[model samples]
Target: MWKWETEEHAKAVVVIIHSAFEHHRWYAWLIEKLRVEGYHVVMGDLPGHGEEGKYSRIHDETVNEYIKYIKNLMESALSYELPVYMIGHGLGGTLAVHYLKKNKVACAGVILSSPWFALQKHGSLIKSALANLGSLTSNMKLTLDINKKALTNNLQGYQEMDDNLVYKTNVTVSWYKEIQLIMKNLFVPSTSQLAIPILLMTAKQDKITDVEQARKWLLLQSSTEFQFKEWPLSYHNLFHDLEREQVFMYVRDFINNTTRGLGYIID
Candidate 1:
């Protein structure tokens, strides 16, 4: 767990949840920027991420377990006794949605960046079906074929990803099975509507998550105040792309404006 505070008072505390196969250290750059903006920030490493959990070995985990982890981590920020907001990336973003819907957390708002609400197909239907069936064994391990180029548009970013310390390339069948169940529930609207504000950021060139599908599901939620920003010239990892500073600026401006009750009007 890591927390950064500014001398000046902050409107709200922001908890950052990093993407899949990554740890809290990976978000240092973004955290520093948040601190510079005078926002209190808290971050943590997920169960299967960080140095303790290596890519060569991944545990069998379910959707429920992932949600439990997220809830526990957010409790640290809750101790501050301030309105807490969440900024989650990729898989972390999906977990945030599940956490918000299930628990009555006193969060003021949320930001989801390239959330994996829907997945892109990498192979034929038969192969996909086999993999899904294979997950029933629980011990089955599937190799992930991550295209480095799809991670970011910047050449330097691509090289850095190749050498990333906490990167995971192997996923367990049970993990995929659990993720499928979570995705199914997300597509269907919830009975109790979400009341807090949301900012859903979609990548135009994302190769991992389905941006259109995410937009469609988000539009179905009518009870929440929300805004959607489609970032162009970006891949799945928008912040690690060539135009990272611009992306960070957009997020900073959003949080600042939201704090002052000057949220950007929907187009």
Candidate 2:
């Protein structure tokens, strides 16, 4: 189900997508901020996380399945007769990119916060290759979430979040493979037929996704309307970082600027 807040004079709709092991509540502050600013805010739980039933481990999910969920959500919002904008973090960010590439999903713009384009630290190519082999041979439950430092540094509040609210962080081999496929598609040309603006945030000290790779991907874009910000003092989860207020300001400015230009937002 979707939870939403609309101001009396709302002008635009903003949809917040959660990270891989997290629920939609991760964007609770952002949603409230947007609603207070007269923008309608909508968020929902994705399959295998939050309110949705866990179908299988992370690796077991196919990209098509994830895309279907996003498409259905976007369609449902369109049914309500509202202009939609997308804001996604981590794996959710990657899913947003896939959605923009595949469909003419109407949106004023898109905001990506430290999207998981490439895992900076993890299994080697040889290990992944072997895992692929094993996956083909047997239905092995690849226990891939071994990174204890995931919620450290920038994500200090992660520990405060209940384990059940956020996922306990276990993944399978197929999930890693799915991530690899998504990353591979990143370097390919952008298929968005719409000239919707894009905002991408990267953490300078992030240990999870490869910041440099994200930079390279952004550079490949021919559109100059895109905005890129690198937070030198922040880590992976920019929204929950110690300097999160600054990050939120960045987010607010981007949304305000682009939507104002389109005449869909004011102030």
Candidate 3:
């Protein structure tokens, strides 16, 4: 786990959860942005993701482990006794939804960036059947074949990602199975509504995750204060995209508004 404290008095603590196949280092820009904006930031590499993936790869058994890890991070954020907000991207966003549904942690708000509720393309029937069978019986790994061009339009960002040593391109069948299980359960009606404010952003041109699925999930949320925005001409990684300044502005505004009446002082 890593914590970046702001030089100024903080208005709140923001815990960020990164997507699959990526690590905390990829979020350096976002972290510094939040820190400079007067918010303490907390984040870590997911299990079998960053430094951990060097030794062990993600398998079927790490599903519950991921939730436990997030719970620990959330506990650390709560220690500051400040209003807490969570930001989750891609698979990270899906995990955030799972964590919130099962746990009763107090969060002032949540921001989801292009959450991966469903894939943009599912392979042929034969391939799907084979994948299911492989997941049930083997721990074989499969290549994701993710296109860098589909991620962001920033050429510098592309270069940075290409040079990243810990960026994984393959995942175990069990890992895929676990992700599917979580996505399936996300649609089941919750016993209680999540009353906290939520901001869900999606890229209309995202070639990775299904935008329609994200929209459907947002409508099912019982939170009365939830907001959804779909950005046109953007890729899957909105934070690393060309309109990131505007994206950051929206994030700052949401946090400020959510905490306005709860003793949050604006500069």
Candidate 4:
């Protein structure tokens, strides 16, 4: 885990959870932005990802492992004695949901960026059958064909991500199965409402996850305060896209609003 303390008097701690196949390093831009805004940043790689994935690829990862990882980060963030907020991207967003459901942490709010509750594309029947069969073996690997261009429109950001060696594009059968199970339970009626304030953002042109599903999920939420915004021209990675400055502004506004609502004064 890594923590970036704000040079100014910190207003709150923001725990960032990155998307699948990516690592904490990819969030340098966001981390610095939050720090500059007087918010401490804490983030790290999930199990079987980033540095760990470099040595051993994703295999046999369980849902409990992901939840536990985020729980530890949340605990660390809470140690600052400031309001703790969570920003999760893609699969990380889904993991955040699972973590919140299982653990009763003192979180100020949450922001989900294009959460992976459902995929944009479903596999063919044959491929689905193979994946189900492979789940029985649990160790079978599948190389994901992710389109870097579809993630962000900024040429420089796209180039940097494409050249990054830490990103993993492979997933094991068990890992896929685990994620599928989590997605299935994400919107169950019994646990649909999250008491904390929520900000759900989606890219209209996102090709990685289903935007409609994300919208549907947001509508189902019964949070005390919830907001949904769809970026018309952005792709999957809203923070890395061309309109990142605007996206950051929205995040800042959300934090500001939530903090104020909680009777916390922000300097």
Candidate 5:
């Protein structure tokens, strides 16, 4: 787990959820950016991810059980008694969406950066079938093939991603299946069911998640308190891209304006 607290009480607590095959510290830059803006932040790696992402080797389980781990993390942040907001990237962002759907907690808002709401445009149907089959396999240790280069266009970001201690070049097949299940469930629910504020971001050049699908979801969503932005020059790692300043500004202002007065400025 990773956390940063402001000197005084934070105006709002922002829980960060990292993308696949990466730990919370992958969000170090973003966390400090939010911390300077007076928001408390907490995040960690998911199972089979960081060195300590998993507490123990658990018995074989389904996707719902895997989601429970993130649910517990969300609950821990809510215990702070401050307005809770989520900043999730990629597959983690998808988890945040599912969390809000299954539970009716008073989440202040959610900011999704390249949420994995759907698979890549290529081989999506085949991937879905394979992932679904992988889900039911008794082999819990199976690994899924992944393309790391698609994460970011920045060379330094890729270097750091490779240097990370627990980084896995590929994720478990079960994890892929879980993501497939999440995306399906996420799309099946009525957009009208959402009640909290939502900030959905799409990476214009993302090769992993489908930006068009995310746009359609945002268009159909019922929450009038929502905002959307598409980073035209960014890759999958929006926070670590050359246009990161713009990404940070959107997040900082969203939290600041949502919890406090609307003093957000762009330009």
Candidate 6:
């Protein structure tokens, strides 16, 4: 349980989920933006990445288990009876897509900033072979970091993060194994039943995840209400980039347009 940013008289509640190796407070600026736009925002520390955790423990769980944590989080917030909207980055985006595919959580829509359809900056043939092979073998941690530099644009800001307070569980063997499976679910070829609209923002310069792969993933989506934007100057952490205010505005306006029944899907 993290916190509710507004006094509770918000027009809607925006729930934010952060990427791996980061904590909930990482979305502080985005939360502020939503507050200014007259929305209540709630953010919680994911199981392993924040101050408090659970009986099951984050590192010990498989990727599907981790996804269940996200759904449980959404269910708890939906109980508050505010129309919910979800914004997730990287690993968080993957979780959001899973929620859309499997559950009918009543959300206004979803915003996915650089969703991890495929990990970034790797030899395509080699990476695919390894990813597939790892799925069959006992080795769980065979995956490699695609772009290590994309971890943070603000090195000082990253260093200032509390060292004792872990931000994420290290990417595990089973986690990598599970990601291949989750990716399969994301691009499921048929049964167009996605219940909510989606907005996907990718960075042309993002080194951690392939922006082209993200575009392909969006293409495979069965939902017609899908939008994609490629920010030429942005990196993996677009929400925290120098032009972050613009990113925030993009999200706010998208929410408003969707709420007003404007079919503003883009690419």
Candidate topping lDDT: 4
Better of 2 and 5 by TM-score: 2
| lDDT pick, better of 3 and 6 | 3
Model 1 lDDT-worst window of ten? 258-267
Per-model TM-score on C-alpha atoms: 0.88, 0.86, 0.92, 0.93, 0.83, 0.81
lDDT minimum window of 10 residues, candidate 2: 137-146
- How far in Å is the alpha carbon of 219 misplaced in model 2? 1.5
Ranking by lDDT: 4, 3, 1, 5, 2, 6
> How does residue 10 of candidate 4 score in lDDT?
91
lDDT of 3 by residue, 146-262 (tens): 667789987766665664455556666676767877988888887654678999999988888988888898888889898899888678998888777888889989998888857
Clashing pairs in 4: none
- lDDT of the candidates, in the order given: 0.75, 0.72, 0.83, 0.84, 0.72, 0.68
Model 4 spans > 4 angstroms off: 122-125, 128-136, 162-166
Per-residue error (Å), model 1, residue 110: 0.7
Candidate 2 residue lDDT tens string, 1-267: 475666557667777777777777666667776777767776787667765544444435567877888887777666656667788888888888878877876677888899988877654335656545544523444454424356446444555444554354665656666777888887877555325788899888787888888878777765568989999877788877767788888877887788678766464
Relative to the true structure, candidate 3 reaches a TM of 0.92
lDDT of 5 by residue, 68-124 (tens): 877877787888888889888887788788777778787888999999888664322
Model 4, position 124, has a per-residue lDDT of 29
Best by TM-score: 4
Which one wins by lDDT: 3 or 4? 4
* Model 2: per-residue Cα lDDT at residue 49: 75
Query: Residue 158's C-alpha lDDT in candidate 4?
Result: 77
Better of 1 and 4 by TM-score: 4
Q: lDDT of candidate 4 vs native? A: 0.84
Model 6, TM vs. native: 0.81
